[model samples]
Target: MNLFRAASLVSFLTLLSRITGLVREQMVAAMFGASAVTDAFNVAFRLPNLLRRLFAEGAFSQAFIPLFAATRARDGDAATRDLLDAVASVLVAVLLAVSILGVVFAPVLLWLMASGLQAEDQALWMTRVMFPYILLMSLVALAAGVLNTWKKFVVPAATPVLLNLSMIACAALLAPWFRRHGIEPIYAMAVGVMIGGVLQLAVQLPALWRLGMVPRLHLTPGGLRRSWHHPGVRHVLRQMAPAILGVSVAQISLLINTQLASHVGPGAVSWLTYADRLMEFPTALLGVALGVVLLPQLSAARAKNELGQYSQLLDWGLRLVLLFSLPCAVALLLFGEPLVAVLYHYGAFRPVDVAETVVSLQGYGVGLLGLVAIKVLAPGFYAQQNLRTPVKIAVAVLVLTQLLNIYTVPRFGQAGLALSIGIAALCNAGLLLTGLLRGGLYQPQPGWGLLVLRIVIAALLLAGALYWMQHHWSWLTLPKGQRVAIVSGCLAASVGLYFAALALLGLPWWRMLRRAAL
Candidate 1:
């Protein structure tokens, strides 16, 4: 398999999802603006989103994929298929119970997450309405694991576009209708979340069926009990134990940050969320794309006892993160205000909101490389079936993050929350890389020093150009059409200059498309 090709395919598909996601965010910002209601919505959505990450895509996938790949390698397709059924059965039963509890305790969860929410009733209602989203998304995650193991990356990568589109439609069509009917427009977004969740899972079924790998879930009580006792299920649960803690540490940081942001001000949660939307462009395009493509292949390599190939995979992923993410980090730091203004400043989205979001965007940029690096680095331990090491690193980082937050949050506000997370991510990534090297699990390839020098040089050039454009343009004062046009042109030029500089420096950037074969 061509790792570059697979990763590119996932990246391209993810680009579509992120683009539509930005559009969704733009609509939300235009209609809702940065207010207590928007904060309520953001906080409410985080409930299911948190659990989805903690259980589904985070610990579950981290545990399941490596084992799933190894099972296929050692026991063949028939055994793997049976393993899938057992896992799916157990996952479904748990999801059903969790969703019910979330709905029943929506108020308690919302208060715990964001006690400062002004629109508590709206948030509670929306939380109940959207909590089941975790059930659907968890199933989608299961399907994604199965499809990725089969090297079917497109559907899994593309399904998120459906979610984005659903929200766009709701914000466009349903929001106004709700206002006319004397209902809060924000509730439309909750309905969109559910619709999007259903569509996302619905789309995955066909892809799973095409591979003849659709899991036959056991829905009955007896069947669920039997599936829970399955050996493969037990092994996955064991793997998920430390994996869950690692993911939980990160989520706990987010929860604490959200609680902090809520108390800071009304718009803090929404501001951070809008900035997060912009940040996702680089993260999803590079970090997530590479992580998804690398994990299965890394596990396969480990299964065959190919230590060299495993090290090479990690090296390739890290080099790509540095090469691409540095330029993105530069853009975010130097060009964030213009980007935020151009993308989000419309209708109810005031100039002040643009300014607020830019701060968070730049704060996140401070660790874009590390944030992306962790996506690749953590998987090294996960693929080695060693989840505890990353968990320990994560727990320490969690403490460090809160300690930094004590000083930064008081001074920087929501941006301080963003900064703390960014610094902690850098610490986390550094420790993970060190762990990998100390264990001899990963050996750095030659030319890393030269690669870093080239990336730094090119990033500086990009930063200089972007800084000039940012100062020259009146992004906040310009008319909408002019702002969009100039920002688009400047972005194009910046990208061109970054690549041109790399080429002039003898970096061979195009060779990325030819590297990382599995």
Candidate 2:
């Protein structure tokens, strides 16, 4: 499949997963509210999620995919199968060790991540209950990387839907019974997470079997060790170490937010979590979709020393990201409160919670553009096996984020945490783009500058129009029916205004769409 088509397929599936995830989160907020249980659950979920990214998604996949792709290119299917089995064997063993350690030391881990919480025991309980998820998910991630190499984006992207579905089912059907039996609903959610991970891994097995890529169980360390000596594997590892650090740097900003939120009043973590969920909707659907689809293509092109193709893919990816991301960012900034209120204002999630969460959501919205750009740009380095550059930049941004947090959190509370991360994302994006240019892997074509200028202008126009509508009209403040109408109207108007601006500025939306469609 072509880059655009691949990205579209990933994006569509991702959108479905994200929407379902939003529903699952809404259920959690309604049932748990922004209290100790919610905070504990949030921290618990984040801990495993952090590791999943660190080992599986961030470092492992970065290392695995390029070499896997290269092996496919040079050798035949058997070579690829052997490499996969070797990697899978090592992956399962390593993750099992890690999961066991996590189960044994859940309290210490929770204490470190959320030190400010007074309810340390509560936190530890949730962590212990949820930590097993990391093991299941890491395996899922390994399977996902294998699938992505086979150009099977659907199953991997769709796997997240199982997670959301599991959580939603548990919350809707099982939570009440658990509560009646004097059990905490959070435990039920924890169980749901473990089940979700199993389902996620299971869903991919059929696809692997179909491709004749099913990994065989092998306990021998030599097979995996051979990967270290292979040139492609060495190159991937070299790229992954820095990419891991780079991704970790970005994650530190989030870690700071989580820590700072813990220090704030009750419900702070939930509020931040809710805001993040909303922001992630667009980022996951657009940014992640592009990143996943672009990396293998870019990696293969770079392996063949095809700089022109790599550069073109980067260009196309950036344009497509901007095309969708810029408008979504604008919409979030404009209607953040209304969106938050609509999705999560029912049951235990009171109006006050909505108000607080929306503040953080809006702060996140302000940095949405930078966040999306960082997602689209960082893959370029990883594709070229140049992970260290992004890592250094990420560490710098991490320090900056913490410094900002130290200064801002005392003054602005949880919202300040969001603001600090947003600023850090902007800095991170600038550094990534600068690194790309300095490395001579990415440079603007003649129309590139003009295209960006037009996008900015269109965004500005849409923002102005939304601002006026928000201030001059009371539509957003209306009841449910009218509120939906008003939000929908604002969305339509903003979209129309942006497209009009694009056309007026001589941007080729139709041509881009046609190309993407083809």
Candidate 3:
């Protein structure tokens, strides 16, 4: 697959997913507001979501994809199939045990994660309802990795659409039923989450099957033993062990922020979650999708011993991230209040909620480049089958992140939690870049100095225009339709000027794209 073409497809699909995600968040904000109930839901979701990252996104992908792609490239189809069967079967048994334990120990987990939660019992109950989502989502992650390695991006990318649609349907339909039955409606959201997980896993099955790579589970005793201990599985196991540490350390930072937010106030967790949902828009659309496409290609490049191509792909990723992400961060930093107001200042969501969300949104915006940069750079380490470097970096960043939160959270509340995340992201990107360059693993492309200058100049022009526009409009006072129209226009103007600045500065837009393809 053409790297940029594949990246564009993933980006478009992911953009749809994120848009649906925004609708889902808007539904949550409208129904529950930044209340203790929303706090309960956010805390409940974070634990399982963190685990999902560990098994599915973080450790597993970092470890699994490079190895899986290499197996496909060098070891042939039969061996690749054997690896999948072993990994999938063992993964099922492990996750089943872990999910059961999670449900049984929900309160303990909740206390560890958010001991300061004001509505501790409510959060605990919600945590139990959502703990099983980790099991479901982990399986979904494995299925997704398999499909991605096979270049079947459609099913895996489209699966999130089902998840978002499920959540939206449940929030709109089932929550009201639960409320009518005198049950807390968030319970319905938890149920929606489980259903979504099932669909996410199930929807990707046909894709795997078409590739003839679906691993069937053996239910009998001897069969189970055989599937768990394939010789090829040992390499995956070794890589995964260190990857778990890296994933855990990374999650520790988020958990620290969530825990700190709990201590700050009743609605702090909800505010942070809401702000984070918006902050994730660009990260999801550009950083994540680009990373997904780059991983298998990079792994393939490494298997072929193409170091020059490896450096070029890595450089391409960084260039695209900076080119797109910098302007996005600036836009969010400047227009965050209006953006928050337009999207979420409705129903149970009040002016104060918007104000709180805007603070955290801008905080997160500051780190957008770091977040996007990490998506590509960490893959540089992973693609070379070097997991230890990222583990060390993640550990160091986790420490620095919590320390910053210690000083910042008390001063800035939810915004501090958000800001600390940005600081940690920047630190991670810096460390990873340093390690890559110093290790002599990656070579920088030419024109980086000029590229950085162009992006900065364009982003500054966009920021200035946005700041000026902000003074001319009363975002809160305008009618909702008018507010959207005016903000949309401002966004259009800012985007145009950003590109125009880049062009007028003698950096033709196509030059960046052409360089990335090198």
Per-residue lDDT of 458 in model 2? 93
TM-score of each predicted structure versus truth? 0.99, 0.94, 0.97
For each candidate in the order shown, give its overall lDDT on alpha carbons: 0.93, 0.80, 0.86
Candidate 2 at 127: error in angstroms? 1.5
Give one digit per residue, the lDDT tens place, for model 2 in 48-85: 89888888888878778877876787787888887777
Q: Choose the strongest candidate by TM-score.
A: 1
Give the CA lDDT, 0 to 100, for residue 328 in model 2: 84
Cα-based lDDT at residue 121, candidate 2 = 70
Per-residue CA lDDT of candidate 1, range 1-518, in tens?
69888999999999999999999999999999999999989999999999999999999999999999999988999999999999999999899999999999988888889998888989998999999999999999999999999999999999999998999999889999999999999999999999999999999988888878889989898998889999999999999999999999999999999999999988999999999999999999999999999999999999999999999999989989998999999999999989999899998999889898999998899988889999999999999999999999999999999999999998999999999889888999999999999999999988989888988999898988999999997888999899999999998999899999999999998886566555
The residue pairs in collision within model 1 are none
Pairs that clash in candidate 3: none
- The lDDT ranking, best first, is 1, 3, 2
lDDT computed for candidate 3:
0.86
Error of 3 at 516 (Å): 8.7
Candidate order, TM-score descending: 1, 3, 2
Best of the two (2, 3) by TM-score: 3
* lDDT of each residue in 118-233, candidate 3, tens digit only: 77777888788788888778778888888888888877787888888998999999999999999888777878887888888888788888999888776467877887677656
The numbered model that scores best in lDDT is 1
RMSD of each: 0.9, 2.3, 1.5
